[model samples]
Target: MQNQESEQVVRHPFGKFTYLLCSILTLLVGTAFMGSSRVSVMLFCLLFSTVLLTAVVSVCHRHKTLGIGLTLVVLMLILNVSSFLTRSYSLTVLHNSLVIIFLAFVFYHILSAVFHDDRVTLDTIIGTVSLYLLAGLLWSYLYSTILLVDPAAFRYDLVNAASEAVTLRNSDLQPLIYLSFVTMATLGYGDIVPVSGPAQTACYLQAVFGQFYFAILVSRLVAMYISAATHKNQQHAQGS
Candidate 1:
């Protein structure tokens, strides 16, 4: 019986390993090498799509909806590659939209897995963290789309090392991604400000969602842990 239980645990799909890989890849693409050359950006896009596709397969492989997930992943891959090659605005928008959808799907599955069982394991903890990071990435894509549509959406106080003001396009992804994370964390560093009404609304919404997600996720995990402990103690007492 113990061996069977261990096997079951070992065979669990979409666990800590997958979530950790996704999170690492997301951080690498989103922050570490952003604003690099075109080749680097293309590489990032390709790797990011692969990560998302891996996640979808991991989560949906056992379900009847795997076909749908696979289809989306393929479409996303194609769009991402095409956007990298062409750099067309329409393709970029479509690619961002697909990314958002894929991330949302993965987030939903991770959340479901985290709270599915009474026990809280390492996988659950890692999955929760992944969800948070995924939310930031999702918002970064949204911000990117907004900037692409309206180059004047955001106002950045670009100051050089010499404290000289410089001009930059809002369409540049590095700054928008930085802004997205800052807004998500409610940092309000004031270096990048959302000047347009739509931009302001989106930033404020992201801040509010970030705070609420943190609070709710923490509370849910704590509750699950406590419940699991209580159940285990009850079983111990009953055995005794």
Candidate 2:
């Protein structure tokens, strides 16, 4: 009856948690690439592959938290493409679109879980959807950082033009990239200043976006984790 018992039981003490952690690490690494580039471009591909593999496992097990895990991987891939393409607004729009997609999938997933019989629990549904939503917003900041680096179209130029009136003279790509991260993080030390109204505006927006996204999304993620833990505990007690 060992096989029978195993087939009848499902355990998620930390399975979902581990998957979410992997996704978060992947996103952080992607963000790190914004200011630095020691990691090869191919390595990015590999990192994303790991993220996707985790997502698939989560999904296959019918984990409540798969949505967010999957969304993060997808967003990372999109951002990677945006960076390599050198196209204006490609990353920005792609980021926004991904966020919207995350929200949509979450809504549908949660609704499905609630309506379907025994396929997914309410706790799992809410936890997965919430985490995915938060990750999307956080990843958007990465997109903004990318924009700061290239300032491909009017959106980026506007930010660079207004900061401190100092025109960028550095031809070295690394310095320019570092400047973008600083602008994105709002760590303006006055070492690099925006030269025009548009540039200043871009800087202001990036700072606002970063702070706002973190304040809201991070709180949501914490709440989801707590919910997941509560659910796991309930299941454990019942099993015992």
Candidate 3:
């Protein structure tokens, strides 16, 4: 087992960080460039960068080899290329990028916890953060589908396809996105109002879950710290 583990190779933190930085820059450039005449070319580049970055992060999980990670990533890339050929690439690329972002966020927390300390305390902290991030992603996906995709069918222009408009100006939907993120972190920024039925319910539930998740993490950390302190105290008393 040890020999096999040794034989398996992985990307170091520096390499992963480099990939992430480049990928983020490419994504930003792509987004900015899309509003111009060269939108298709920019978007294609963006998708390519996203796939590359996702593969890098996924491989860092250490649960698999680089070869395995490359295989999965290449398969995803192939699908993306197919989408482009079939002319449904835009939506497919968007969906794939979202999924990759979620995966990268998760792996980042795991990497932070592992390298920072072998202690279970860090794991708890990372786990706590992951819950909120997941909630935010979920809300964003739903909002994108309901408003941006089919505003007329939904009978609301909560968030239209375009970001520049009066309906978006002073809109409550931005607050929902903020609330979704904040509530997940137990921040509970009360400024955002969820007037709609589904939005209100989702916000409330996410807030509850976020608080509960944090409470659990705090309790576990406290217990572990107290146990370690007590043990040391007893040892000192015996020595004295």
Candidate 4:
């Protein structure tokens, strides 16, 4: 009976955050090294975002939502790819903005699922990791969007270290992608410094948010474990 119960919990759609975590990881790692074509980068993001979004929709148990999400994602993918090929800044900015919306949507669902559950199961721990990845991805999209609007917003390094910036359809959006995660981890490598005020503000905020998330999540897990153990012990004592 205990084994069956554990299996049931594992089988729960909302508890299966491992898939979401893997999908996001693939996106992050793949985009970082997927060669020199921005079209390839956008396509890679398209593939994984579709998969991750579908997973979230399954957890939602709403076929209608999945249908709508699929349609919207696909439509954006086509437009974004075209924008990249045509070198259209407006379309590129629109794509990044839409990506942020989808990331936030998944973040909300996974966070609610992980925190509302009283049990500290393996899936719950995995969901927490998924949330962290989603947070980094969210910030990356925002950074990229800001850079899109104003190239000078970020001080470019791969350039002459001054008065030079990268285009959206070149290689990896590494300047922003790398900086986003490093800032979230609070590493502050200083390789890709944000010269503008908005960029500076985003860096500090993400750093603080990352640290608080780690501290709060660890404490919550520990408290839940203690409570479960104490409740089990009390039941055993009463039986004796």
Can you list the residue pairs that collide in candidate 3?
Answer: none
lDDT over C-alpha atoms for residue 234 of model 3: 100
Residue-level lDDT tens digits of model 1 in 1-240: 999988997897556446546644565566565666776677666666667766775568466667778888888888877876787889989988887887788788878877775677777787777777778778888888787788778787988899988554633556766787789889999988887888888899999999998899878889889998999899999999
lDDT of 3 by residue, 72-172 (tens): 56665665556555756355545555544545544555445534543445334544343344445456445433343333322223443686433321112
- Compared with the true structure, all predictions reach lDDT values of 0.76, 0.50, 0.50, 0.74
Write out the backbone clash pairs for model 4. Answer: none
User: What's the distance in Å from true for residue 16, model 2?
Assistant: 2.7
lDDT of 2 at 102: 48
lDDT tens digits, residues 1-240, model 4? 999999986887554676766777777777766665656765676756655575555345577766756766776677677786787887887777777887777777778887898979888888888888778878887888777666677765555467575444222465567887899999987777787788788889999999998899867988998999999999999999
RMSD of 3: 8.2
| Segments of candidate 4 deviating more than 4 angstroms | 1-15, 158-171
Clashing residue pairs for model 1: none
Predict model 3's lDDT versus the native: 0.50
Output the lDDT of residue 220, model 3.
61
> How does model 4 fare in lDDT?
0.74
Top TM-score hit:
1
What residue runs in model 2 are displaced by over 4 Å at the alpha carbon?
1-13, 26-39, 56-138, 141-240
